[model samples]
Target: MQITGYKSQGVAAAVDLVNAVTTVEGDASFAALREILRVNGFFWHEFEERDAEPLRRWGRTLREFFDAAELETAVSLLNELMLELPMHPHLADHDPHGLHLHFAPPTARLPHRFRASTLMQLSELVVQHGLGRTGTCAAEGCDRVYADTSRAGRRRFCSEACANRTNVAAFRARRRTPRTPEGTG
Candidate 1:
C-alpha cells in the first residue's frame, strides 16, 4: 500500500533502526544502511563537515552488537514497546523539501532523532493496526524487519533476494539429507 511522506518517514526510520540491530553480527555497510534508510524517504546524505559527534557518539557498532537471535528478540520487544508512544504533530519545513512534521527533528542529535522518529512511526502503526502487522522477516538467517504494508499481508522476507536464497537453501538441504527406506527408523 502507498504511504505519504510523513508515514513513509515513520516506516523508513523504523526500518533503519531494525537494520542497525539486525546487521549487528552480519555484513551490512553504512552505505547499505544509508540506502535502506532512504528507501522510504529518510534521507542520509553525507555532509562535508557536519559535526560527527551525534552520529559517532552512538558508540557501539549499532549493527554488530545484535546477533540474528537477539535481533529477533528486539523486534518483538520494539513491536510492543512502540505501541506506547504518542504521535503528536511537530510539523515544520527543515529542508528544501516541503513541509513535514519533525516527528523528531532532523537537526537533533542523530541517534536521538532517529530513535524518536522511529518510535513515533511504529507507534502510529500500532495505533492503526496493532502489533500483529509489524514483524521480522520469516526467512531464517535474516534478521530484517518490515512494516508489512502489503495488501495481502503476505510479506515474509525483507527482499526478494532473501526469499530466493532461503528457498534455494531449503531445497539443497533436502537434497543432501539421507532418506530412509520405507518403515525404517
Candidate 2:
C-alpha cells in the first residue's frame, strides 16, 4: 500500500491523463493538456501546438492499461507500449528534485518526455503493486480511470463523489427490495 514517492506521483499523472482523455466530456485542448503536465510535475522546457495529437494518442494507450482484465494482461500491454516508445533512460539532478531518473533525453520533445516518464513510472507501479490497483470507475455512467493506492487495494471509483453515488444507489436498491416476513414468503 506504500507507493514510492515518485511512483505515486507518476501513477496519479497517468490516471489523470487517462481520465482527461477518456471521459465523456473529455477536453483535448492544448491548454488542458499543458495544465495536466504542469500539475503532474513534468519538467518540460516547452510545449508545442503540434504535440497535442501525440499526447492524446499516448493518453488513449494509457487508458487501455485500465481495460486489462488481469495483471498479466496489463503488464503485457505496458511492455508493448515501452517497446514502441522511444525512451532513453538517464539520471539527472535538475530543479532540486535531487537525483531522479529521466526516461527521455534532455533534448527530447515535450510529448516524448511525458510519454516516457509516465509509462516508465506506471510500469514500476504495476510491478510493485498490481494491475488491480489501476482501473476505471465502477459508478454507472462514469468511466474515469483511477489508481487505487489504498491500504486495502479495494478502491473502485475515480473519486469520492462517484463512490458516494454508487453507495447511495445500492442503499436505495436494498431498501426497495421486498423482504420475507419471518420466512413466511
Name the runs in model 1 displaced over 4 angstroms: 1-5, 24-40, 46-89, 93-97, 105-107, 166-185
Q: How many residue pairs clash (N, CA or C atoms closer than 3 angstroms) in each of the candidate models, in the order given?
A: 4, 0
Window of ten residues with lowest summed lDDT in model 2: 1-10
Q: What are the TM-scores, per candidate, against the unseen true structure?
A: 0.56, 0.91
Worst 10 residues of 1 by lDDT: 59-68
Tens digits of per-residue lDDT for model 2 on 1-185? Answer: 34666656767877877877888977878888878887878753387789888988888988889888898889899999899998898999876467888889989888888888888888877877787788888999998989886668888899999999999999999999988899696
Candidate number achieving the greatest lDDT relative to the actual structure = 2
Candidate 1 residue-wise lDDT at 177: 98
- For all predictions, the C-alpha RMSD in Å is 6.1, 2.0
In the range 141-185, model 1's lDDT, one tens digit per residue, is 677666665556566677798889998999999999999989988
Instruction: Report the C-alpha displacement of residue 102, candidate 1, in angstroms.
Output: 1.9
Regions of model 2 farther than 4 Å from truth: 183-185
